[model samples]
Target chain A: MRGRRAFFGFLGKEVRHILRDWQTLLVLIGMPVAQVVLFGYAVRSDIRGINLAIVAPQPDAATASLASRFMDATDTYRVVASVADAASLEPQFRDGRVRQALMLPSGLAGALGRGEPVTIAVVTDGADPNTGSLMEASTLAIVRAWDAGRTGRRAGPRIDVETRMRFNPTLESVNLFVPGLIAYVLTIVSALMTAITIVREKEIGTMEMLLASPLRPYQIVLGKVAPYVALGFLDVVLVLVAARLIFGVPVRGSNALMLAESLLYILTALGMGIVISTSTSTQRVAMMAALAGTMLPTLLLSGFIFPVSAMPWPLQAASNVVPARWFVVITRGVMLKGAGLADLWRETLILAGFTAALFVVGIRRLAVRLA
Target chain B: MKAATREPAGVGSGAAHPATNVGAAVQARGLTKRFGSVLALDHVSFEVAPGELFGFIGPDGAGKTTLFRLLTSLYLPDEGESRVIGHDPATDMWALRRRLGYMPGRFSLYPDLTVIENLQFYASVFDTTVAAQMDTIEPIWRQLAPFAGRRAAALSGGMKQKLALCCALVHSPSILFLDEPTTGVDAVSRREFWDLLARLREGGMTMLVSTPYMDEASRCDRVALMQQGRILRIDRPSAVRAAFPRPLLAVTAAGEGAAVRIGLLAALREHPDAASVWPFGSTLHFTDRRAGPDPARLATELGEWLAARGIAATVRPISATIEDAFMWDMTSAEPAA
Candidate 1:
């Protein structure tokens, strides 16, 4: 209990410094807002006509009208140029005027009317896979819809599987990002700030005063970690509030479970901060290690933007070791799935185990230094 | 606090008895610390006797702080043994930590906590209370009681130092290690600070303080002059002065320019027995060579030589201080051309 009080005592002091500092406040609050707004509008999964060029070779009124109908349904996207044959599709696609080119053979319409097999070629640029996938999917849906209206049904039986993106029906970008953002902001600011702060004390000569006291070296290390863990929790509160107020992000999971998982995460993050502190001697080096080493991976590989399952196997495996990755999953499962502790008990235990392990490692490093 | 010319055997308070000798309270043999490829300390052997105001005087990068950290168990020496208060620092670090007080150079107390809170934080960690340390830290804490409510970071450098000293003393440790405690403080603060240290040293608390300031060397009972990770000499400041191995002459000119140029150079050439010619201030200092050298004759000959060069300067013999000893060690690190 005295250690708890000592812990809170350290935590309070750390919070005081962070609240009073202006630059850190700016970074913590400003970055999330900017990133959320930037990603929200810039990223989309559906594509329409998308600069379509028809290299039909033989133009028909029906084909031209079909292209017009396709553009009209997909909002703003339209057919930009009409070519005489398949030869023109390559040049138009390569010059970047179109995302894809539609090539229809001379007898394509006749074959479709006669119920004969008709093939249409869709040539695409594969540089951006996500964009390419979206373009291909949307175009196929439009063509299928058009064919269905012409004939009552296709020769082969078709089945529709209605998909609903739970919690985020429209798949809003902010909803997808809210939980990831919380983990990232908390992990980075908490781990980095405390780590650099302790190292800075050593550089300036203040660490000697702490070392001289009856305060065990581990106690000193804890005293430094305690304050930032509280700070990390405070950032979590800010993120939850901001997510709701700014982006309508729902917190569907159990509130207590969220807080508990977050506390475990804070422990791991603070442990990381302590590890970094013991390794570096200057504020500059500590800050670099914290930001470059921790923040970047949390943001990029934690399924914050690109889905981890969708990422290549190596990156997904690499993400497993990052504490932030677990935190993000916990955040999303709770915030979006409304999942209880029972649903995420395995993840929670892993986090608990991780925090304990890192704490032990950090304490051991401090002990070695003291010894 | 005594403002006497000569420091007594005892320090301020809680000092060890005057009977103990070097490293009796703290001892290290074959002590070495390697960080990757660079050796911060190499087989350094030293001791802090009980109740002695021992100082480790060295320039920046002289491994004073590293040695201090090793003594406090903030670092593990790779190849040597260290004992503090008869306890092996590596094995008995926790117990040793509970007995020793360390004051690092910077003001490391909680900047946001009230001065009392910072003291209490440290006290409580050791499982003691502020009431327990009233005797040990009262002399220093009295100065800070008025501003106990203020944050530690907001305090002036001198006040902060006093607060830090109070915090270190509150736990009542037997030995203390202060690493560059006076750095970044003003002159008045530095003098006042050393006075406080002298008072603490009198209490019979063994102290191993490292300082770059040469003036503070005189206030210590004994000093270890260090440079480039090696001890040049360790003795009483007076004794270190006595062992310079050559006579030192001071030269001054009425005109500052002539004193620096003609006087120092003329003195150098006029006496081929000159071991070293260094600019101490406005005038240059000429030290003796092993070959026979005369300060009086050298001054006269140097005066005529400078006159021939159209520069008039005064050259005379002067007392050597620890700074001379320090420069001697600094030059030792460098090879002669």
Candidate 2:
């Protein structure tokens, strides 16, 4: 009973420390909401408001009607310019006034009247390959739809291909990022925050007094990290709520499972933090180590922005060790895919393994006495 | 004190072996520690009697902090062993930690925490409450009560020290280890802090305090003069001063000026019979080569010697202080190096 009271006292002290630092508290609570809003609005994969130039050497009813079709096919394509010659569209593409250009052959109405085979070319700027390809595909889809509507019969022998995006059908990038955002925010809030807090005690010499007290090293470690766990959970909930209310992302799976997995991941990140604090004697070094050691790996190697399967073999193997990698999978699986324990037990096990291993290393590395 | 009766029974029993079963409140036999290439504490050994106020007096880097850390179990010795309140700091630190209170060399309390909050936090950590040990810390806490709501960082150096002391004493530990409790504090506050320690000592509380100020040594029941990780001497303040083995003289010129004092010191160092000369405050301390000499004869001779050198000065034989004894031991022990 006495030990439990001491642990709570230590835990209360840790909470008081965080509460008194208003700037840090602001960052702790506000950073997640701000990051979610920023990334949700800024990072987009869907094509919208794309400028298009129609090149027609001859103006005719067919060409004018086709230009109208491009303009009327949703707001995805906005006819920014209509040039009489294909040569005139060069400056439009060069200066980025136009992102895509649809070129119709000369005498296109006469050819269609003669029922002759003719091809139309779709030109696009490929500076950013991802958006460039998306624009081209969207332009093609519009042109195919227009052609099919114009012809009474189907176009000669074509292999029609249809693609369906599962989970996030509209392919909203925010849907993918929200899950990763939970992992990212928790990693920073748990690992980086805990590491710096622990190192601050060492820097200010309070760790010496704590070590000299009746509290065991494990008790100290647990007390120091307990507050962060709560804060991390709050961050996860905040990000989840913002994702749902603001970004329209859904947690299709069990809310309890998502929360449980997030708690587990927070523990893993905090374990990483404890290991970091044990090795560093100053706050500056611990901050740098946490950023470089945990944050960087979570951002780059966890398949948050980039797929781990597409990385090199060595990087793929390295990604397996980043706790955030497993967490991202678990969160995306549970939040988006509605996966339960049956589908996510492997990732869950790996995360638990990481937490266990990191905590054992952290506790063992923590010295009972000063070196 | 309310908690005085709660003192552990095994403290003075001396039941265990390992050279610490001498019934001392704190004991060490050849405790040593090293940090990289620096030998922080050599094979140092000492003991503090129960209810005694023991002080380790030394300048910076004299291993006073290192010794306190070892005694408090904040550090483990590389060689030998130590026992605090009859519990080996190495093997039995849990019991030792609960029974001992440590105020580290630095202000270890949460700077952002209010004074009362810091006190309450420490009290709870020890499985006690501030109200329970109010009698033990009442003297210091009464002074700190006015600033109870203030953050510790805003307190004056002296107030900070008092709050730190209050926090250490909140649990009413059997013994206390205070490392340089008054290093940066003002002179008046330093005196006040020592007076507080004296009151605590009167209550039969065993304490081990370290300080870099030599004048503070006189207030300790017994002081260990430490230097370069070694204890030069350990005894009562008066006895340590009396142990100065050389005849010493205090020389000062009639005119009070920096130039006159500097000139007097230079000339005294050049004297053939002068063993060592150091500037002490407004006067210069002069030691002769001969061991035991009559004070009047030596003073007259030194006065005449300075007069013959065309520099008139007043020379008087003065008894050694703890500082003088410390300087003597430090200088005498340096020749071998």
Candidate 3:
């Protein structure tokens, strides 16, 4: 163990660096808040209006009028353009003018009048998997409603599945994503940013000057870890404040719990940073590794954006290793549901384990790598 | 000569002051180091007393930096052992670290921090504050104090070097390791910086500096001539110059036919008495093969040969320099010149 006086002394200097360079701290906190606000107001799961296209080739008065009812009724769908045949469908899809296309085959109205089986082909673009899935589901619901009205049926389909989006009853994308984005950006800036910084110093020879001093390796490590932690904590508060003021989002969880979770999350983040710093010999390598390692999973596999439950088993397993995944869970449990420690015990333990393991690995890496 | 003998009490010790004594600032034995396949130091052995200005003189890859690293405890020697101020670099590194200062070739001080801040930070790292060292670093600090608040990155190369020096000195260590400290500095700054080192010697601080500059090597109490990871020679600067085995001659010509005259003088190497001839300036620097070249005949013969080439010149003997010894040592094919 390092002497407390030296460790705390070095830690104090690091804190001084953090306080002086407050801009980095601001960015750390502000990023999550802004992301949350942007997602909350501008995105939603239950969309009001989606651009829809139709091709009713019969061109009869009743057919065209009924199609008009589907578009104008309750504002569920907005008619973008009408095509003549299957040939026009491809052109419309390629041009990106239509998300989902409706095709009522010839004599579709006569079949429907005779109560014969009538089915409308709903062709949807599969490029944007999220919106494409939404478009497909929403179009099916609207067409079913029209069929139900014609049959004079009051009862709906069996097995009424109710999805209650936790933390965000409205299923706002920002509400689900803002906290995770905060973790991502802060991790990038703190871990990856500072990792390259150490290599840069070593390259220029300043590390030699520092290493030659009486300060122990642990003292040096403490000094580096201290400043970034304060910055990370401050960033959490900044984003939270901005998120509430700008996006009308409230912290449902206790602020203290949120802070404690953030501290653990940053510990994991900074540990990875030290490992990276010790391994790399140059700033370029550090930057490349930092950017690629921090950005990818935070966006794709963290359950911050795409639901982890819906992801492939392998990807879900991979997400289990990513620190951001645990952080998002902790954030939602603490911030949205206002849950205490019990609600996040498992995730909290995982995060603590990651922090401890990374720290051990980082220290071992320093010992093996430096001299 | 008498004034030269009255050396400062804590400065350069007596002749044969190369022992790695108990109180010695630095000690190394058979210190061999290799970077990958490249042998940086081979069986290197040397010592610096408590207050000696020792220098490592050689070409770029002559293992100067490797030796410096071993001394500063930045590198662990592959073969030999080193004790800095009685602390084994391989084991008691943390303890050794407190008593030694190091300045690398490039400026490593934090660019974002001011000069004063950098000095203060380094000072506090050793459990001492900057205020206490203000008296010790007053001279160097006075030069940099005016712009102490500015970021170190924006300072001129010379100023940056000075600030780096100040930070290294702020802790007031027992020994200092400077690896090519003045390689990129200006001549004026180099002189001023060495002056500071001399003053530190006055206060009893051992310094081991490495440089490729032969001119600067002359100012050291003793220097080690290294090449290919081995020490070729180690002695006082004056002795190294004196030990050159050949008598030297200096020549000059300020006329338009100087090149023609220099060309003919080079042709003297074919003569029985002429050992080697090299161009130093407008004229040729020549050395006698044996001893006592007939000056009258040599001058007359060279004058006639120059006249044949429509050239005019003058020649006379001059003192040998450290560069001459280095050049002679590098190319064994060339007879002693």
Candidate 4:
């Protein structure tokens, strides 16, 4: 098409605008880097040094060894108090001295030696469900290991189930957070940046000039979003670099595939931006709409912070429509799980389908407005 | 005048009284456009010959910008048809776009880009470069050469308008649509801008320029005098002025004091024969309610009437300008059937 040359010319113009405008530069480079560093370190979900109180009323060597082994299980928990009686366990939890408490009954070792059933009570603060559940799981794992070791020396009832954490063996939240962070940064930056830039053109009245020119609506949209795709990919690299080098998050899968999928997601975001810009005529309204439209959906609905499966049925269905949800799945699958396209073709296809759908809708809306 | 005042054709009426000659650059028949409930351009029809400097003269909200936008193919009309360079703007907008250059009423060039960048960008959009059309825009671009590195937003109003015009012409289109090229410009700069247009006319470029200033009407080869989205008259500037049906009197208060001016204005408005008395600079242009064959007797009567109010004034008959004709047309309720 003869419009190809004009497309590049307009693309160059949009690139120059992005390069010259400090606000756009700030949004493009500064915000993503800052949010990644913040989310990686300060705002991360890794919980450490959860205080635990142990109460062993019998005061036997087996109960004390069990308590000591639980404390040494992982850095996630610490034995803050060793209560002499069960009466003081409740006080330690109430006074905020301990977030979790482990109670070994008086006959725990006797019951094991005599082949009688024994019950260990693990109490945790339910104020924060995430931390509480994590503490409870840690206590169970330690207790299970101790019982299994004792059962090997003698005959006892045990179910041997080996649990393997496939992707992040250490279960480090950094690995999980990094992928979500990339989704968030790319969505907000690319979508918001493209939206505000187009709205600015409309506000300044240059859009009418473009419409009056020989440049078609598709070329105009492409010229606008082509630069943003590059910017978004650059942000993807910056986030991945910071996540890998700074936070020690890994990229175990194909980096090329990860980047290609990221580019597809970025296109989806840019398409959303064009749609928003077409609906709005001013930069302020566009900015507000972008933030409201992309930020909340990416953060809450994309499984970036909360798990989609654990969400309500309606919310889970809604998340399927969020572009970032599929991207996040692809990012986690490729980067954390070392998966290939064969493993992630479904998510990739969904993202591609979304990009195409949004681009079509955006172009049609733009044509309507221009008409 | 008969050709100029031909009634706009009704909706979907094909080629009624085609004013489009072989040399016509643009033609519109019953081109009515509405924005929601607001009637922007109503049953408006006109044509411009190739290489002619045509002007649409009206005050603000007179639909001058709307007509320019419609002809530029930026908006589709609700009814009727418009052809630019022998192509319908409604259907053949893309083909027409390559042949037309439009400078919108607002300063719309990239504000962050340098003047040269803006020029180069627009030229490239037309699949050419600015260097290819240097001779065409040289007279204007040379004036803007020193400020090539300056951002468009930093340029003064006149310089900004010049840069806009230069960008619009960078592609060397067959027709140029300038919507109020000198609305807010200083008097000196406005004159210079029109002088530039006159030079463009010499090189045989078809231009359709709109302006709110009545004085600039004389600069055009012909003008469509518009008000409230309706064309009242279209003719040469002198003819439009001569079309003013009533005689005009320039009433000058014979004192330098502001109080004398105010008192004279108040006394004249109170006069029974004063049809309309509007301030024109320090003096006043007064139109009598009654048309009379005897101008000398009317002037004498106006002088005695001012003296009767103890305000010294002089009344003299003067030729009506476009402004007088516009005011007369605006105040009239209906166009002559």
CA shift of B279, model 3, Å? 5.2
List residue ranges in candidate 4 displaced over 4 A.
Answer: A57-62, A84-87, A105-120, A140-166, A368-371, B1-21, B334-337
Tell me which of candidates 3 and 4 scores higher on DockQ: 4
lDDT for each residue of candidate 2 in B26-124, tens digit (9 for 90 to 100): 778788999989999988877777888888898899999988888887788899887788899888888888888899998899999999999999998
Q: Pairs clashing in candidate 3?
A: A29-A235, A29-A239, A39-A174, A40-A174
The digit string of per-residue lDDT tens for model 1 on B18-134 reads 333444787677788877887788667766667778888888888898888888878878888978897787778778877888887656777767798888877776667799889
> lDDT tens string, model 3, B1-337?
1122111112333355845366777777788998899888888767677788888888998888888878777888899887888898888888788788888776788776777777777777777777888887888899999998887878987888888888888878878888888888899999988888888878877889888988888888887777777766667788878766666666555365755565566555655666667766565666666555555555666556556655455666566777666655544422221
Identify the leading candidate in terms of DockQ.
2
Candidate order (TM-score): 4, 2, 3, 1
Instruction: Give the runs in model 2 whose Cα sits over 4 Å from its true position.
Output: A43-45, A52-71, A79-124, A133-165, B1-21
**What's the residue-level lDDT of A184 in candidate 2?**
93
| Candidate 4 lDDT by residue in tens digits, A263-296 | 8889889988988988998999998999988878
- Shift of residue A325 alpha carbon in model 4, Å: 1.3
lDDT, candidate 3, A1-371, per-residue tens = 32554566566655555555679656555566665655666664555566678877876653575587766744557788786676776776787777777877677656656656655687888788887766665666556545566553333323222242533533445566667767776687678756865676687766777777776655677777777777778778877877778766667889999989988888888888888888887899987888777667777788877888878899999999989998998898787788899889999999899889988888766641135
True contacts kept of 3: 0.56
Q: What share of the reference contacts survives in each candidate?
A: 0.56, 0.83, 0.56, 0.76
Task: Classify candidate 1 by CAPRI docking class.
Answer: acceptable
Candidate 3 overall Cα lDDT vs. reference? 0.73
Residue by residue across A105-168, what tens digits does model 2's lDDT show? 8987777767666778889999987688668767766665566667643241132312413455
Q: Higher lDDT: candidate 1 or 3?
A: 3
Ranking by lDDT: 2, 4, 3, 1
**Model 2 steric clash pairs:** none
